[model samples]
Target: MADYDNSRYTYAQVLAGTGYYMKDDKLRYSAGVKTMQTKLNTAGYDSGTPDGKFGGGTDTAVKSFQRAKSLTVDGKAGKATLTELDKTASGGGNASAEAKNLKKKFGSIISSFASKNSIGEDVLGGFILTESSGSGFVDGALKIRFENHIFLKAVPSASTTFKVEDKVHYYKKNGKWYKTHTGKQTSEYEAFNLAKNISENYAYYSISMGLPQIMGFNHKVTGYDTPKAMFTGFSKSEDKQMEGFCTFIVNYSSGSLLKACQSRDFTKMGQIYNGDGSTYGPKLKANAADYAKA
Candidate 1:
């Protein structure tokens, strides 16, 4: 069983019932809550949608778990309750199985890309592993993340053009109240498709698509004619996703990513690809090493 830690939010924040709750008037979203919800579901406690929001269902589930485990009967997920929850949910099969499954399905494709590009298979494999665990398709649909900020950047007038509603946030800064559009919606493809009706190109450009999770705006670097083309291709086949990934690394930033992969420099790779060398670099390196062993 893997040890789940709250690197993003604190235990105190969770217990105070303010950090991860995203229901009704609350708009906070937490990856920590998502992890807990998944584990709770695995341990036979239903936490409803598992949408990274600690709502009423999650509260009920937590209280039920605490009652059963003889922990404090509060709905809050304190350190002890969380630890026990992890232990209970640890029975859900091998955690590394997903990575292994990725290799099993696309080992040949990874090797082909490595050989064609003169890069290490483990490096490429590790990159994919870090991105999607093995499969680019979730329930037969290409894995996608709709970036609301990117959408707004691409189509600044989408709110008026598409008749989309906005979630306005007004905050005091420098003793003046300013309003900003946080997003149209949170991680919902419906909002993305809605925007696509008015401007298909910008809609496609606003999402990170498929196994590699490359943003649609990078279609040129990935050798696609357009963001829509890349999205269509990636949605159809992981083979095309691998092709796009290989192409992206080779061409991104004038081949710097390729150079990094060639030297097995995950720090540089992470810096170039994810803009974070200190943390994502080590993670990619570890994933590559683990893939090699597996």
Candidate 2:
């Protein structure tokens, strides 16, 4: 167990930078870690000293906080963790108001884009609800999905290891290979660093960007000249990000998915969009129904 303190820390300090504090291949040392430690300690989570190093104590404290808050309990300070931390630190209310605001702001954007793309607004709304629950930003920026396979492919000659759910897997770190489940949810800065270390191309493809979570590698299919260009453009605003998403769906399915969405054929939509016929299809239908009521 760690020691707890009642020293308050500002939300800004805690949320500054990448807003991540996790134990990966190496312990993280950053102001974000220190701020998180301080916040966790203040909240009676016992994160040990407010040091900038993310070790076992910090990880356990983060997990405890997540468990207490009904979060994912991944022991990672991702967007959700940070948001809950901010709310707790500031004594803010639930996210219902924020969700309502996001939905209101997104209505016009979704309507316009869906109209131009010949899709139904309800379908788009359902997708948004499924993907982000009306929250466009994750930890104060666009969402990021780290792709370790792409990163490793870019370095074809380095020795690397990936751990997933208590399993450690080895990689040659050299030569081109693509493997799934190598990626982890991470902040944009950390994901970007992984990409930069590999190559610009890998950086773009190694992570999905924004609300639609479009992969960087699909920039060409999505009508962007380059992955960097797509990333920069999508990060501008929620509207642009959704537009990029719409464009990707149109291009990827050659407009068939849009037709499916228009007809409320969530089964077809899920098959095309998610690449399988699974529970996602019915879940999407349920989401569509709920959004229609809203």
State which candidate has the highest lDDT.
1
lDDT of 2: 0.62
* TM value for model 2: 0.55
Colliding residue pairs in candidate 1:
none
How do the residues 184-231 of candidate 2 rate in per-residue lDDT, one tens digit apiece? Answer: 334345546644764767667767787777788889877799988888
For each candidate in the order shown, give its overall lDDT on alpha carbons. 0.69, 0.62
Give the poorly placed runs of model 2, Cα more than 4 Å off: 1-102, 138-140, 158-188
lDDT of 1: 0.69
What is the TM-score of each predicted model, taking all chains together? 0.58, 0.55
- Please give, for residues 61-112, the per-residue lDDT of candidate 1 as tens digits: 7776776567877665867777766555633544355457777878888888
